[model samples]
Target: MFKNLNQKNNDSIRVEKDSIGKKEIAADSYYGINTIRAQENFNISRQNIHPELVKAISMIKKAAALSNFELGLLDEIKKNAILEACDEMIDSNLAEKLELDAFQGGAGTSTNMMVNEVIANRALEIMGMQKGDYDIIHPNDDVNKGQSTNDVYPTALRIAVLKLLGPLTKSIAKLQEVLQVKEEEFSSIIKLGRTQLQDAVPITLGQEFSAYAEAVNRDRWRLYKITDRLKKINLGGTAIGTGLNTSHSYIFKIAKHLRNFTSLSLSHSENMIDITQNMDIFVEVSGLLKAASVNLNKIASDLRLLASGPTGGIGEIKLPAVQAGSSIMPGKVNPVICEMINQLSIEIICSDQAITMAARDGQLELNAFSPIIAQKLLNMLEMMKKAIDKFNNKCVKDIEVNSDKCKQILDNSLAIITSLVPYIGYEQASDLAKEAVNQDKKLIDFIKEKDIISNSKLDKILKLENMTSPGNNLSE
Candidate 1:
């Protein structure tokens, strides 16, 4: 792109030319004609590209400029100006000018050019020159030295994901911690356990909560381990990963600078060409996220069931009264927090499917579907973190177990007789269970009134710990 506006007089607009042709850009605009062309050509979603991605790209530009200067490929003056411009972008809203959708053509060429143009113009201004004065700091020759969108875009994407993973895992850990606390608090509350929605036996509520915590802990570790894959970025692999216009020296220097700039353990891919051709890493990350969402969905469903009602349903626990459940009802509260998590979990699952499909459609040397994958993956990470934090603070922390209700429900359930199988014999116990249910009586009361066993023996046999655990220590 060229900007021959050095001798121009107009204040409102300036003319810039690319191979495609010339167009008038707003003189006050930081973005150049390439960004405008992209905005016009691909008016798909109209959403801004991920801000983290823009920041990642800016860091790449800064590190690339510093490496070029260090290698004598670029002069000190231009390098300093570009570095400052990149800092401003990293620290401020300079990249808000990148107004393109997440879906675009050319494997993120438009988004890459948008970053290049913004940095080049900002560098020119930092050098006391005009915004469009490419004669001093051209976007391609200087700001984007020895880089291609094919390589830089995916590299920036990896860095962005790496940055987000820390917070996401922390959120998972927080939820797990909350569940663990709940497990400890409910350890003594024996309740009727169900299988296939039918009462089966006695189980302490703590065991159910412990299982939820273990699932979340496993997800946290899975996400934490995926970092090893995200750290292996395909940078320094110019167009098509062959290092077409770059050298080994420049590639090695750039990687060192990138590591310092982003503070991430970013390793340049050993097989850049293979990394460029395959997008399996994204599919793997999405698969793990889907697994987490499945666990979260089930946990949320369980909470909703346990907190179903105060009068008619299984009121074994109470959630925080976040909001009114109905407009017409006088007094009713809902499990809106878990419901929100349920909705977001389903959305994340859907986004994972999109990522899977995108990963599968990569062409020979590149995947134009990367923009969509990046968009979905980052979105999943961001929203899931917020959802988990909300769920932990608003719902899980304030949960109250209805122990009286639990005791009543368990005493009334005939399934509790399974504990007496050894003492009364299964056939005799089965007969007593049928007799109790037929006469609308408690199983314990029916057995005691029938003089089947001494009341003191029944008390020892039916203690909560004895019924919930393996041994009763009441030998015949």
Candidate 2:
């Protein structure tokens, strides 16, 4: 969205120094020297870290500033200035000012520093000072007080993920409800059920939709079940969960303030080392996402087959004609929504492999690879939710049931003979079904020629309700 933002840093530059050396930063930009260094080094992934993450870390900076002020560690003016800057960062597009690529080294230290630098510089503007004037509102001494990148980055990541799950869970529930609505809408339409791609029995289109509804409902609950674990976080573990170079009292103080501030039921971890070093929670999340994608892929594949052809294929259901399918063939319309969903599910499943590998590669102290995990998991959630919303609105809601086509397929299938078991007995039904195939006639017509059963009784046995559902009144 900020692609056209003024990126001409070379036009007017300001000098800033770091531990290693000095570098020139954009004079008009809020980002500082550490950001410039990372911006120059890692340009691999797309520009800008996830904005929600930037907001999360900004919230952390605000929380840290507030807590330090309450503890008498920071003066009120700098605290208020930092707080105002954080509000601006959260509410406005200030995150676009930080121009480093998402994939970077240092276990997200660069990302954390980028946020600190931008917030500090913005706070300097609010405090009537120059951008790089660290003496007034230093990024490290003021904005990032009592916090390390090891603590800030992962904690902010947890907060961002929790925020993202809100929209995604709603998307899942809406999808389930829409599927249920379709289930009820198509409840009485009978169609052939197949196993191994061969006719096996008769089932209603509603029954298939109901199964999809149940699958999606399970997925929603599976994600909801993980929410409590996601709330548990390691905030005070400054470096390696030891709280080294951090105020012990500030540990619990930050947790209390954040819970009241965000209203998210956030908790401080008793075993901060476990939470910091082991990122199994995201792995579990990736697995649930994979399961949901599998269900979606199955539904999309079924739609692809059911909406196969208008003349030469099953044609039992018709998808919404969103756009012209073929460039040359004039009236051709395709199930592009289903096709899009199919491809999206495949992308999600493959991305899950990357998250799992990143989770496993964490060293003894910290998961440096969580930056990739954060990028991958957040992207999956954002993309999946939006796509699922489009699918529900564009594809599922306007779906039309080809009732005539469904009845024709059921009427012509040899599986219809299975309905005659109660009236004619199994052996006789099977034999007549085979004989009907050999005679190249529908089972009903073949039954009439052989006088296997009276028309009245046959009609009752093959009635739409009796074949599609259960408990026929007919008996031999």
Candidate 3:
């Protein structure tokens, strides 16, 4: 149904020419071109391979090279070449010359091929040898020795994500810091609290800000908890979970070397069967991302509402103006970063859905879609990390509360009746609240007219501190 998307017509595209096996090879549509075609051919969704997969690829190569170097599978000279090539890929210089898409069906076989080609070509350049000189340093026998895409790709993804957990924790910590500051700043400001988008009672603005802080803190802790689980990899499992052709010593040896190289707390799974079958860790990470998204989305939405207007709406708060608000309207500033963060939340939420769907697709022995699941989950993590960084550094840290606006709304609020409970009693206060709302009169005016409390008493209770702290025990 979607093959038409890959159709090539009369239009010409520039091509590079090279030699392969004594024959001229045209770089027209063969090298990594199948991936690009598949991308177009399978327009089932706009979803592509996650960017985090690149980090995963780099980690795997590093792990493999370190293992090989320690176990004498390769000499220092070859290992150095491999390391240099892998580093180049990490720096993303090879991407300009290569035209591969990040997605493929053979459980990242295409990605593996792309990696092999990049390393081989770069190694050739390093050795002063021509590109594709397999005999000098073959892509398969040398670079991919004793490894399969199945083990290597997933292991790389795990390591990459585990590495990212550190920065993500820091981002969450930064956001928590911003939230803490807001909590202190707004501690004495009371406003009507909403339960289901309807007014319920009064709550301190500080309380709401503290809630956001707790949420980010929880997510940071959860991500840290899962980091150790991701450290357990399937590198020694080989191709079909049998460890075929691999000696018993090489299994643990490779994992140990990889651990030292990455400087990460790494371990090997006890059961290859369970490792290949259960993707619970992947699902767990995805679920955590979803939870984080919920908190962030709610926070973003609330910020937008709180910072709604300076003239018309409930403009109790003000967000930093990072960009011009309108193309036509002059002197306007917009809340674009908040909007972007909200959209990122939605995308991360959708990635969780993809993870769930992919996890459920696993069968008896192996999950064919583990690669995609790993890719998507890691992508969500990175995206969330980036969003949190931007929101905290750019938006949250610079937010300002409109003091005069908040005071104006609070002074005119009938919602202040709850604070009068100790003085006027609940029933009388409730009655006065309803009367004030009906007449659209300020609570101060209502209190003064009804003589429920003396003017001096009302003034004392109406103080911000008194409203925020109901246990002051001052008599009316």
Candidate 4:
């Protein structure tokens, strides 16, 4: 039932009453009393619920309507109204009107209620009735039939996460492809490879880029595998896992309708109680995201160090100059894209920690912190996707290897002494390395000065190719 507010010059107000009390709602608003209460109670984060989540929830409602119609539980008129309302919500992006804070109490009941009230009012409009006419089409009885926030919230969260993973996977794969291209481009440029911040051996620039490509490829694969975990959803398990107040036929058939509606490979969880009680699946996906973050962080750090300076530091590679690096230094350029990715990675890592704690803090039947987990996880995914794209287009693809610098550094490195040990024995090679370091001379130059071996043998032993890989013995 709805009551028009009779206050003078307040024609734009309507009265909606729940168990708590009556509240004034906007006449044009699709949401109702529960949503208003949530908006007023939890103004913690001014940010509203994410649009993807709202869309996912709308899809669930549409699927439920279709399922109820097929089961002969709901009349065709109401089903058509609900379906049309859902279509309007999705097509016109009506979720922008949902103003409840993403972080809230009641285990996402407020979020569920916000969606329900919007759909209920929109359905009433489609039926040519005024909004908040629960007597004709109740939000709980008609729109949200056979569902609960416990089931619907987590299920919608899974759908939203799966939707986001598609773009994230593509971004990561694109980054991997770019790194592979760089590997081929830098294949022949040889450089010094360092361990523990000290030169250890000779390596081609291509080999370093290949390692980065391989790491990203692994992350892409893990992202693909994590979708399987999300596919199993706990829909139709109203309240708890007992499937209380829902028909067995509805319980078994809802997932089929949801899969068809969402075009996602969704399946009903075999054990609803387990799925509801444990949010480890979300934690598992978050862990994989963390793994991807770790890989990106390491690659970005390596690029920053490699592109440290043109006159000092490694200076073996140059990153694309996107902007002026400093306000004070006139000619400075920084690896801002790499820095951005590094900072984003750190944020993703911290988000994962939050999700982990939220998952662990589950009480008895439900996890009240799902709102925060969903918010943090979605934010991380979107941020990481953009960061990867920026890093790939602006940095990785534009990386320029300094071949001259590589050769110069390699010439000065005493790490080449490793190649001489196979032929000269360990004690002699150690003495030569010490002398080369003490005299501040190249290993090749020191060897030439001492006449340790014949010129031809020394030349054969000290080949750059010999130092980088394994093959024939240097003594041979």
Model 4 misplaced stretches (Cα beyond 4 Å): 1-10
Candidate 3: pairs in clash: none
TM-score of each: 0.94, 0.95, 0.83, 0.96
lDDT of 4 by residue, 1-476 (tens): 11221223446778889898898877767778888798789998788888888889999999999989999989999999999988877766567656789899888899998888888888898899988788999999999998999999999999999999999999999999999999999988889999998888889999999999999999999999889889998888888876888887897778888898789999888999877778898899899999999999999999999988878789999998999989999999999998998898889999999999999999999998999888888888888898899999999999998889999999988877887777778899999999889988777888899987888987777888766567632656
Candidate 2 segments whose C-alpha is farther than 4 A from its true place: 1-12, 421-428, 452-458, 473-476
Query: Which segments of model 1 are wrong by more than 4 Å?
Result: 1-11, 423-428, 451-457, 473-476
lDDT of 1 by residue, 113-144 (tens): 98899889878888889889998999999988
Worst 10 residues of 4 by lDDT: 1-10
Best by TM-score: 4
Model 3 ranges with Cα > 4 A deviation? 1-52, 65-80, 95-98, 197-200, 420-428, 448-464, 473-476
lDDT (10s digit) by residue, model 3, range 1-476: 11121225525342322232133222222232334444444445455555456545655675677667777887787788888877766665443344344444666666665666557556666777755566777676677776777677777778777777788889998899889999998887777666676555566778889999999999888988888788877776777666775666777777776676677877877776566656778888889988988989999999888888767777878898888889899878777888988898889888888888887887886777776686677677788889898999889988887777766666665666666887768998888888888988877777789886777877777655665454653653
How many clashing pairs in candidate 3? 0
Better candidate by lDDT, 2 or 3: 2
